[model samples]
Target chain A: MGETSARATHVQHGSHIDTIESVDAVFREQRKLSFAYGAVFFVVTLAIPAMSVWWKSWYAVPIWGGFTANYLFVSLLYYLFLWGLSWTYIKKADALDERLSHMADEIAAATLAAAEGGES
Target chain B: MGNLNIIAIVMVIGLTVFTVGLAIFVRRFTRTTADFYLAGRKVGTIANASAISGDYLSAASFLGVAAAVYASGLDGVWYAAGFAGGFIVVVLFIASALRRFGEYTVADFAFGRFGSSRIRLFTVVMVLLTSLFYMAPQMYGAGTTWTVLVGAGMFGLSPYQTGVVIVGLIIMFYVMVGGMKGTTLNQIFQFWWLWTAMFLVVVFAFTAGKFNYAKGLEEVTAENHRDVKTVTVAELTADDAALLASVETAMSEKGFAEVQAVVDAGDPDATVGVLIPAKNKLHTLRDMFFNEPGHRYNAFDQFSMVLALVLGTAGLPHILNRYYTNPSGSAARRSTFWVLVFIGTFYILAPIAGLAGKLIIDDAWRAGLAPANAAYVDGLLLKSDAIMPTLAQILGGEWLMGAVAAGAFAAMFSTTGGLLIASASAIGHDVYEKYINPDAPEARKVLVGKISVLFFAVVALGIGLGIPAVGLDKAYPALIAMMVTWAFAVGAGAFVPMLLTGIWWKKTTERGALAGMLVGGLGSFFFIIMNILKQLGHLPSEGVLAFVGSLTFPTLFTFPAALLTIIIVSKIDGQLPKNVDEIWMRIHGTASERHEKELGLDKVSTMFGNSKH
Candidate 1:
């Protein structure tokens, strides 16, 4: 009887808390990857204006057409940046879903605890 | 409108049936706010990517860019480049963050970030202003199509007015019943059909001119530079004999003298002229490029043009709101990445289509089969905007013309639907919920939102119809682009800085947020006033260069000013209320998945304590 009661109590314990904590490691990794991606994005967004300045620079030699090589180089860089971001987003999203499911559990647990405390 | 082309009528009926069918199909899926707004946030990357592309392409991209290119020359490609690059900026900087932060709308983000009722009210106003401007042009463009294709004068109303009512009513019906789900499904299908039609039209145009493409282009180029060829004008008299005598004398004497003198001088660039017809005069393509009367490209203006595209993407509320529809922040991010691919691919085809139109028209003119060839200089692209419509007529006759017409209508309708929804939600949900009826039932609140949508849709339709009555039909795109820039400038200047700071910075306060939003909003508003002045002839062209040109540093100028305003005001107001970090974390840290599932209206309402019972 005592063993049965202990199992019931365990089942009724903070299952959500346990689930969320279990995937904390994955969330940590995802966060790190997201930040890295963010940094790259910030750099590329800045590059467009940077190239605008580069386009009018007096000292650069014109390549192919009248446009300097910098214009084409920047365009190619942006394209690659986009390609890289797309690749990373797909790979990282799989792990992110696991993290989010855990987060939902945590939110549920916290809400339950707060309700219990309010009633008490 | 008795001039209603049967093909156009058929296409419109087809579109309505398709949209209604989708609405009926998706109705079962929508049970709550989440369903209404985000499609239950379960939209897979590919479908969502296509929908996003459909939404982003707008009338501006579908018809305007190609037309602008066809009408103008190489310079019109700037529009295409700026627009396509906007998607890249969206994918990288803003989409994921927005999805992660906001639950229902952008106003939800504004409210959550600052916990200020004032900020929510301020944001709603901005939303209304931006959405109205964005929507007006789409409605106006629809009117133009109706007039040109279907003929005018229905029930004592012009074609423009009839078009306004017809499109507005149809769209409102579908949107009211189906919401975002309806919009997405219709947009995706329309996108597919539009793409197919565009592809066929382009292929047929190019194939028709296969052999002639090369020869025609060379001849057109030669003809374009015909003004440079050596020729002389003899100043014709009224009588034929007098004109002939004058031409002969001029050719034998002064013309040869001037030609010999030029040869002796050995000026490589200068032309030595011989006698020509009395009416015809020499002109060069180089002269048209450099000396043609209009705004020439300058480095800063060019830079600002690009900068507007990049920064403008960050500020568009309709685009920002799409992120919230995804199931997770990562999914939202992934969707944006997919959008980059979809948009990039679609945009690449547009230039090819533009080129095809260019070649086909040139061929027809060279074959002496076209009557209008004499109107435009040979080798010069006619209005780039006319390429699609002209190509449609060339390849498909009345049937293809009808299809192109339908595509244009779809493009305008879908974009208008998205913009209207965003505006209504901002006003009804944010403004009314916080201040007007804080304790209102969920059903009542939704009713108000619907009413707002109806109201705005009507207002937009009215303005669209009215614009044509005022004779602004021909200038719609340029006017729309200009106003859109104002919306972008304001959003970039005001909302972006405030929201970014609120999310990322710990020191942001209610006072600072208020001040920043005001300054950014007002500064852009003032800039728009100057733009309007220029458009209306109150301000001279020179006045614009002096005053408005200096403020092209939209974000850079407004950012520092808003930052300073916020910091100073906040300091004077003293410390902010407690629990700021917790609230900030609550908003910023919510995963997209949790929000996605709760995207249902019931769940969202309950989250905010909506008393459904």
Candidate 2:
């Protein structure tokens, strides 16, 4: 029983450290990923209208089914663009939260100091 | 049209009771100004998302877009595409930002930034005017639908106008009683039925109908090539011929001459009548899409529409009001994201149904289910707004038609409720609370909101029921777009400019903000009036002049002008209000209480958090 307890303690320390490390790693990675994702999203959305313009009826088949397919294709791209952005946002949300919280702390300190000085 | 089928009647009645009951349940939440105007700002992401979808998709999307598609192929899908794509723009640039501002109404945001009561009052008048313009069309549509379905004229009033009154009353009641909470709950329910009914109708129409597209095309092609007057009546369908003969005989006996009574009475150049076939309608369709004097259906039109949709979403007062319902900006973002999902799925199916509708009518036309040239109007098989009603009939007969009719009512009511509520809040809370009675507490403000709702509803009813549809069908899209644009301009010019500057730029002055809003608002107004004048033949369509004129100068001109004015004026002024940074911190910060706790801040934090730096 004593041997088991010692083993468990060792494992617990290892896992806890691993989790904390992963959290820090994620925050670091998110800083870079957010910019990259933002760039890609901005590009693709800008491209859709551009393509639709440069080549109006690029897939113009005389058939109704063909037209329907084109419509669905454009709509699917739009939906995918939206969902992808939301996913990217969610992924970096933790890092964003931390950064924003730090900014809030600074603003709060500065404002409180000003208020106290004004009163004096 | 008065012959309501059992299925249609059941569906209609069931939906009516369900919606009314839903309204009653939600009414309990509207006891405070916060509750009435913003659903107490505690609504969940999914709930708010669904409600926003309900509010956004009006009678136009639910009924008119599909009908337009069914009537005119391909081109109608543009409306759906443009509208759905607008939400993407909202998600990217607008949703979270608007939520962060924490205003009760759009005008409040404007005045908050500008610190000018005068600017706020101008916005109040603009809001009322824009809301009325949007409200009138929905009321007109609702009335027209009822008149067709119930044959309301038999009760003495015109069927079209009576339909308007009934729909207007229901919308008013719901808005007045439940406020935003009521409107939100009711919309969530209606959106489901609207999608389901439309989906079922589309599927049924697709599978059950005698649709042979190739044959239909051949028949239309043949009809198009030949002079419509000289078509050979098929000799094989003797029984059908006899039936037609008997009907003609009966009509003649009833003192309606069956014989040739001026087969071509009006000038051939005049607008085509109801009995005209799909072939004849095709001419108008081609002309509308490709040959109209200044109608640009090319990529430029598509892009402009997308731009409108993207920017327009930001400007919509009703949509802005919805963001206030969520507890946090994150929740607002999530809700908006969900709304895109829900709306995207529904819009995907929308065009399919539209195309399917076109197939159904074209097929039926080929089979001679109608008169050689007759179109479906109000299910009487006349050529009018037949695409929607006839498609419903073709899909599931009278039952689906009834459901669609009910859907139409739901669409009208849900949107009108949102508009009325927004308009009411603008009058009741923003204008009344801020300037009229600065110390009116929250409960009194809520009461004022309710009264405002009632007043607007009565006015809606009066205009909807009493004012005859003056040139409704011919100018429907133009009118709807024009009014809706005003709302957008208010949002874009007044609210968006102020909020963006106030939050992001430290050098934004009150005077600059006010000037920006006026420029933006007045610019949109001017453009809108010009468009209207051009439409009414008051302005000559000088090709390049009209083309340049149509670009929403408010977006291009006002946005930059406002930005420039704010920056330049703020620089010249050389001073901002004291504690401006504190206010900026508060507005930019998360929910004040949580934000305070997170930062381990105190009472000073609340002031600093909301104060403008």
Predicted structure 2: lDDT: 0.58
**Candidate 1 residue B526 C-alpha distance from true site, Å:** 2.3
lDDT of 1 by residue, A1-120 (tens): 011111211112222222222233333554566557666765765555454334344213344332334333332334555666767765665556566666656654665577579999
lDDT of 2 by residue, B1-613 (tens): 4544457657766777777777787666556777778776666777788889889878767765665444443444555655666665555455654666677887776676556787678767767766775676677667656655665354567767677767777777778877887788888888877877777775675578654433433332232211111111332124555532433432323212312222234232333212112222222333222101112234444444444445566667787788776666666667777887787777766655655655566556556553222333222223224355566765676777887877877788788989999999999987788778979876788788888988988787776664344343443232333344445544565555655566556568777776666776666667656655554456657886575445532455555666677777778876665545444433444334244334443112110011121
Runs of candidate 2 with Cα error greater than 4 angstroms are A1-46, A56-65, A68-72, A102-120, B71-75, B209-263, B266-271, B274-300, B365-386, B441-443, B462-469, B476-494, B543-575, B591-613
| Top DockQ hit | 1
When only chain A is evaluated, what TM-score does every model earn?
0.48, 0.42
lDDT string, candidate 1, B554-597, tens digits: 55566568767877877787666465544533434443234344
Q: lDDT of candidate 1 vs native? A: 0.58
